[model samples]
Target: MDKKKPKKVFVQGAIPPEKIANSIANHQSKTNIGAHSIFLGQIRADEIDGKIVTAIDYSAYEEMAEKVFHEIRESAFSKFDMTCCHIYHSLGKVKTGEICLFVFTSSAHRKVAIEACNYLVEEIKAKVPVFGKEIFEDRTHQWKVNK
Candidate 1:
């Protein structure tokens, strides 16, 4: 029987840190990885000018988001000497200080893992078709695509 390659991409709704950690551990065990780097993005309650953001409503052009995310994974693999990658972003509502995105990368060495993690996060932020709604303390909301 042929062994399956480690997951090249992971996309989900409201991914938890524990789940992401588990996936990373499982991938590390399957591959002889010497390093794993992770990026965790959290929602912040901040006052943008005069508006205070209270919570976030996350939505995606699901088909387009998936397509873009997969393309990013493939490109990351091609560009970096990494063994595996995972990308997860929240759906529906995510409150302040909760996780919104998690990107994990494992490689045979620390340098590649670190660089790949950074690159993957930047690429995803720039390319994914996910949109976020900033809910203010006054109960008003505004949708903004990540920039």
Candidate 2:
């Protein structure tokens, strides 16, 4: 993978399982990679104020978000000895139990891969401009705050 090029990090809706599977498959050819770490962020149906969250509608300032994503990727590469890193985030409605974010990192050792993946996830949550609206089952909604 070309680390210098910016990848399209946002997906239109919930990320499909096949895309994740394909990513893993694609990395099989890289014989030097000894460890791979993956993080999947799934939407949860949480009861808040007696209402159940049915989904999260996500949105972002695309241009700015992409810039942040690139910076996160670069930072991860510089901080850890990662062979490759990829991140995908959902942009539209993602239902409870659906995947909203995916982060994959690979390296020659387990520690580096794991640390890079965790770093990417934390940086994204802390720095990205993405917003999420929690949609309740009864049609009510509230803006989500990262915790």
Best by lDDT: 2
Q: Which regions of candidate 2 fall more than 4 Å away from where they truly are? A: 1-3
Question: Compared with the true structure, what per-residue lDDT tens digits does model 2 show for residues 12-110?
Answer: 999999999999999999999999999999999999999999999999999999989998899888889989899999999999999999999999999
Show how many residue pairs clash in every candidate, following the order shown: 0, 0
What TM-score would candidate 1 get against the native? 0.86
Tens-place lDDT per residue, model 1, 19-134, is: 87687668745657888898999888888869988878888777777777777788888889888777778888787888888888888999999999999899888888778899
Question: lDDT of each model, Cα atoms only?
Answer: 0.79, 0.95
Where model 1 places Cα greater than 4 Å from the true spot, the runs are 1-13, 145-147
TM-score of each prediction: 0.86, 0.97
